[model samples]
Target: MKIAVLKESGGEPRVAAIPETVKKFVGLGASVVIEAGAGQGAAISDADFEAAGASLASRADALTGADFILGINGPEPASLAGARSGTRLVAALDPFRRRSDIEAYSAAGLEALAMEWMPRITRAQSMDILSSQSNLAGYKAVVDGASLYGRAFPMMMTAAGTVSPARVFVMGVGVAGLQAIATAKRLGAQVSATDVRSATKEQIQSLGAKPIFVENAAGIEGEGQGGYAGETSEEYRRAQAELVSGHLAKQDIVVTTALIPGKPAPRLISDQQIASMRPGSVIVDLAASAGGNVEGTVDGQTVERHGVKIVGASNLAATLASDASALFARNLFNFLSAYWDKEQGGPVLPDEDEIVKAIRVTHGGRIVSERLAA
Candidate 1:
């Protein structure tokens, strides 16, 4: 097996995967080929990969001969237009919205693995791409939000005077929200949060933050299935809006981290809520691409509304690309290892295997994954 690491085409700042890890694949009898200068943003050099026994080649020659390909993002069709058949591609692909891209890979007989579709289970934790990446995004969202706020995050006394602590409100209590709460608490902020699930209140309090329990939240409790949140009813949404309205006035910064699998993120904030915040308050919306939690958030752009800064982070992981790439590389390695049968010298698609069965998109020129087809 020959694995190729193509240069990430966009200015995404993340490498497809690290070469040091690929060296492990090489030691397992797979030849590793990386495009020259492919690991630039991740702070990896060609010499480093060469030391790991990877052959540095041009994109064309590498893709032409590689049996398996890996990337941090999607494959650009221009760079892979004429790739040879049987190139196994694995990455965090947006398979459903980009159906044409999946079709192209299928037409070329490429086995596609959508890392984002990996099941969220205890055994699959090592291979969960969404969790690995969202952890960074969650931490980054706070760092980004704190930078925009006028006041300090933590409180200090006796120095130039007494400094007050900032108040942080987290809208979602999932992986990203939990991280945001942890970061905010570490920064000395008076952190508080709310969620559709009432069960998360204890989890929020465990992180040293007060949980702002919404009134009548029973309507939305336990809506999560498979570690993901399900849609709430309109009655729940209206009641939530009324409950969240009062919390906004006191918050120095607000972070929203809600997301729905395969659907646009639910609207948790309205225009009237934005009007209640102070002038220097900031809202860091992690769900900007899926519409937004803050009203008037433009994806990948920042704008001010009612004197408040709404930060819409398009690719939060790209901000810390080097570390992000390293974490993502580890998850990708764990996932690939599950299917990699070293004794047999090829990937083994174990039927009904938890991790492999969850993310397998197109195998043998057909969409084998039910999550992608339906």
Candidate 2:
């Protein structure tokens, strides 16, 4: 079996497969070919892949006779011109907004597996790209916000006056939010967090951050399918907004990490509330790519409003390309290895398997994912 690792386009720095994963695939009796310079963005070289038993070739040459294709992002259909029909294209295929791409994959008779749609079940934890990438993004959000803030994170006292610690507020207590809270606290900042799920109150406290929850508020039970935050009622939103409006005014740094699966990110901060914060305060919106939690955020750019900086931290994990690539590649490897069939000489995805059911987006020349079908 042949596996092709394609270099990412559109300025994405992370690569899907690393030398470690290429070596693992080789051990599984698969011949691995990497497109030339595929890992350059992650500081890896062709020599490194060659040492791991992977051949470097051009994109067209790499796709020739390939049975499986690996990528950090889904390749444009036009780029897969050389690949044969029924080739399994594995990646974090953003199936929702990229519906046309999914259809194109179906038309091309390729089997598309969306790694991002991996289920939240314990068995699939190691294969979860979202959790792995979001963890890094969360850490970066806090560090980036701290850098943009004019004052120091920790309190300082010397012969002169004392400088108080920065106050950090985190919205959404998911993987990213929790990490952001922990990072801010480690930096000696006083941190607080809020989430639609009341269960996260203890999680926030465990991370040494205060929980800002609305008491006795109805419709705050936002535990969605697949462990994502569900939408709340209008009544609950108003109550939470009032509470957040007051808390946000005093925060020096804010990191918003709330995201609903296949939906636009919830707006956690308003322009009016942003104006209340002191000058030079920083806000990092991790959901900036999903239309932002802050009003003035522009994905991939940092903008200032009312003298406060709003960083549109879209794909913050990509900034740490080396580590992110390693973790992502491992996730892909774990997934394939789990389904590897020694007799078949390649991974076998059973139709009824829970994981296969969850991630298989296109198979048999049709868009088959129930998540998208629904």
Candidate 3:
């Protein structure tokens, strides 16, 4: 089987297949082709890939006759224009919001697998791109917030006076949120967190951070499939807002990472909440790309309002290109390895496989995901 790794476009600074992964694909008896300059964003040169036994080719050359194509993001429309039927494409395509891209891929007679849909089962953990990327984003969010804050994170003592540690409030308890809490605590900040899932209270406490509970979540099921948080009712939103309002006033740094799959980020902070915060406080909104969790946040920009700095950093993982690309490329490699058929010397798409069923978005010139079809 011929596997092609294309250079990422759309200003994305990460490559799908790194040199280390190219070596693995070649070990599987597959001919690996990488587009020229594909790994530039990750600080990898074409020479590196060539040394790993991958031939460098132009974008058109790489896609023209390849059996499978890999990318970090969705391929450009023009690149997919000449793809042949039965070609398999894999990427961390955000199909929930980019359904049109999936339709376009299907129309182009290409089979597409979205890495975001990888099941959260133990066996599939290595292939979980969301968790891998989110972990970096969470750590970066804390680092970025600390840089923007005028005061120090850890307490200090001097002949002049004693300085208290900054107070940090994390508004989600997922992989990213938990990382944020741990990072903040390690930086000597007083960290506290809240979540829609009641079970996260123990997780927060285990990290030496206090858990702020939303009292109204008692009868609500906030845990969704694949270990994601589900959407809450209007009543629950009101109670959550009431609980968070009091805590906002005292926080020096607030990092919001709440998200519901296939839905806009639930707004946790309003203008009034921002207005109530003390001057010089910082808020990092990780969900800003899919509609912000904080009101008045603009994706990819930081804005100050009512004396508080609100950072809406989109794609925080991309900021750490080398490490993020390595992790993401490993995820793709693991998924490919799991589905590889040794005797056939290629990937096997078994429809009955739970992991395949969860991630296979399109096949045989049609949208195949039951969730997307619905």
Candidate 4:
């Protein structure tokens, strides 16, 4: 099989698979083809792919002749212009939101797999793209928060004086929120966090951070569901804002990492609360792409409030594409291995297998995901 790496479109700095990974495919009797200059930003060189046994080819040629094609994001609506039929395809694909694109791939006779659809089962752990990418996004979120804080992370004693560590407040104790707490602690910052899930408080405390109590509110509606955060009621939101706003006056940095799957992230910071912050405090909103947790966060830009900086950072994972792609490629390998039937020399059909049932979006030239097709 000829597997091609098309140059990533849609501002994706990541290549679907690295040359080292291509070498693995080459060893499996697959011819690896890469579009020239595809790995520039990742510091991957054409020479590296050549050394790893991949053939250099043009994007047009790769699309026309390859049996399999890879991409980081889903197919670009605009760039699908020249993609041909009969090619096996893979990506996150945002299959939950792009029914038309899923149908388009089916219409083109391309078998589609969405990494986002990987089941949260134990066997599918290695194939969990969201976890891998979210792990990185969590790590980077703290880095952004620490950068914006004008004070030192760790407490230090110097000849001049003793500098106390900055206090870091992390909202939402999910994958990203936990990582933020850990990262802030690593940097010697005092970290505290809050979440609607009462079970996560011990986890937060285990990370050497305080867990702010949220139980005093009369009714919190639903805090989360399906391993994802849920939208809290407006009354709960107001209470949360009031409780968290008080912390900002003494905090040096605040990182909000709450997000609901398939929904805009919940707003965790209000203008009044933000303005209450001491000058030079920083709030890094990791949920900026989907609305934001902090009021006044402009997507892809930084704004200051009362000398405090609120950062709306989108796609923090893209900033670490090299590591991100490696982990993502490994996830794909695990998924493909789970679904691949060597007896047939191709992916299974009827799509009844668990992994198949979990990932197949457009099969037999039609939209198949009940989650999206509905």
Candidate 5:
């Protein structure tokens, strides 16, 4: 089997395959071909992949007669012109926003699988790219917020005076938010978190952070399908907003990580709330890529509003390219290895498999995912 690893476009620093993973695939009797400079952004050299038994070639040369194509992001269809029909392309394809690209992939007869859509089942944990990446993003969010904040994270009692610790409020209690809470607490900040799903209150407390929850609010059970937070009623939103407004005024640093799968991120903070916060306070919005939980987020840019600094961190994991690449490469390896057909010398994804159903976006010259069909 020939596996082709393509370079990501659009300034994406993370690569899909690392040297360690390349070596593993070689052990599985697959010939790996990587595009030249494919791993450069992640500090991986062509020599590194070569040492692991992979050949480095130009993009078109690498794609020629390849059975499987791996990437961090979906490659443009035009860039994949040389690949033969039935070449399976796997990546975080972002099918919702990139519908036109999905169509192009279908027209090209490439089977497209979106790794981000992997289900939250117990068996798929190691294969989950979203969870692995978000864990890093959460830690980065707290660290970034602390760097931007004027006050110290921990209390310091010097001879002159005692500097109180900064107060950090996390709006969302998913993997990212939990990590932010833990990171803030480790930095000795007074950390607190809130989530629409009340079950996460215990999770917040377990991480040594306080949970701020609105009681007696209808539609508070926001736990959605697939372990994601679902949409809530307007009544719950109003109540939560009122509670968070009071809390925001006292926070020195805030990190927002609220997101609904296949929907816009829930707005957790408003302009008025920002105005209420003290000057020099910082907020890191992890949901900036999905329209943000804060009002004035600019996707990848930091913007200031009402004397508060807002860091719109779209892809924080990309900033830690080396480790992120390692983890992401492992995710792909774990997924393919699980379904490997030793005799065929390749992975054979059964059409009826639950995982196949969830992540497969385009197959057999058409859109196939039920989520997309819906």
Candidate 6:
């Protein structure tokens, strides 16, 4: 099978296939073709891919007659215009939100697989793109927040006086939130975290961070399918707000990573909450791309309101392109390897495989994912 790695046009710095994984694809008995500048953003040169046995081709030539196309993001309409029927395309395509893109895939007679829909099963953990990307975003959030803050992260005793360590509060203790807490703690900041799921409290405490919970969290359940946080009631939001408001006033940095898949990010910090924070405080909202968790956050921009810095860092993982691309490429390789049929010399989607059923957004010229079909 011929596998083409297309250049990402979504302004994302990360590429779907890196040199390390390209070699693996070659080992799997697949001819790998990569766009000339596909790996440029990730500090990889055309020579690097060539060394991995991947032929360098132009964007148009790369996708033409390819059996499987790999990318970091969904392809543009123009790129897919020439895709042949039964061509397999895989990427972190946000099919749930980008319904039109899925339709485009079907219209082009392409079989689309969305990496974001990788089932959160023990067997599928290696292919979890969401967790891999969010882990990088969480670490970047702390680094960005620390750069914005005026004081030091760790407490220092100088000739002048003793400076206390910065206090960091991480909201939504998911993969991203947990990484944020870990990153902040490593920088010598006193970290604390909160989550809608009461079970995450143990995870927070395990990392040596205090776990804050809402007063009315007794009846509210945030754990959803695949252990992701589900949508919460307005009453639960109110209780969460009340609990967080007090902590907001004392925090030097706040990193919000709360997100409900396929829905707008829940607002965790209001304008009033921003106003209550001390001057020069920093807030890094990892959920900025999904309507923001902080009130003043503007996606892809850093803005100051009431003397507090609110950073809406979109595509944080892309900023660490080299490492991000490496991890993401490995994830794609793992997913593809699992379904690769040695006898058929192509990927075989088993009907009964839970991971395959969840991720196969459009197959055989139809939108096949049950969730997206709805």
Of the candidates numbered 1 and 6, which has the greater lDDT value?
A: 6
Candidate 6 lDDT, 179-252, residue by residue in tens? 99999999999999988887888899999999988765562464567767877777887788898899999999
Q: Write the per-residue lDDT of candidate 2 for residues 1-374, one digit (tens) a residue.
A: 99999999999989999999999999999999999999999999999999999999999999999999999999999999988989999998899989999999999999999999999999999999999999999999999999889889999997899999999999998889989999999999999999999778889999989999888686446456787889998888999999999999999999999888889889989999999999999999999999898898899999999999999998999999999999999999999999999999999999999999999999999999988998
TM-score of each: 0.96, 0.98, 0.97, 0.91, 0.99, 0.97
Note each model's CA RMSD in angstroms. Answer: 1.6, 1.0, 1.3, 2.5, 0.9, 1.3
**Candidate 3: where are CA atoms >4 Å away?**
216-222
lDDT measured at residue 263 in model 2 versus the true structure, 0 to 100: 91
Error of 6 at 1 (Å): 0.4
Off by over 4 Å in 5: 219-222
lDDT of 2: 0.93
How well is each residue in 225-315 modelled by candidate 3, as lDDT tens digits? 6788887777888888888999999999999998888889988899999999999999999999999999999999999999999999799
Query: Candidate 4 on 35-63: residue-level lDDT in tens?
Result: 89788767788898899998888877777
Q: Would you list the C-alpha lDDT of every candidate in the order shown?
A: 0.83, 0.93, 0.91, 0.78, 0.93, 0.89
What is the Cα-based TM-score of model 2? 0.98
Q: After superposition, how far is residue 53 of candidate 2 from its true place, in Å?
A: 0.6
Q: Give candidate 6's TM-score.
A: 0.97
Candidate 6 global Cα RMSD: 1.3
Misplaced by over 4 Å in model 4 are 81-84, 96-100, 217-225, 233-235
Alpha carbon lDDT at 149, candidate 2: 92
Q: Which candidate would rank higher by TM-score, 4 or 5?
A: 5
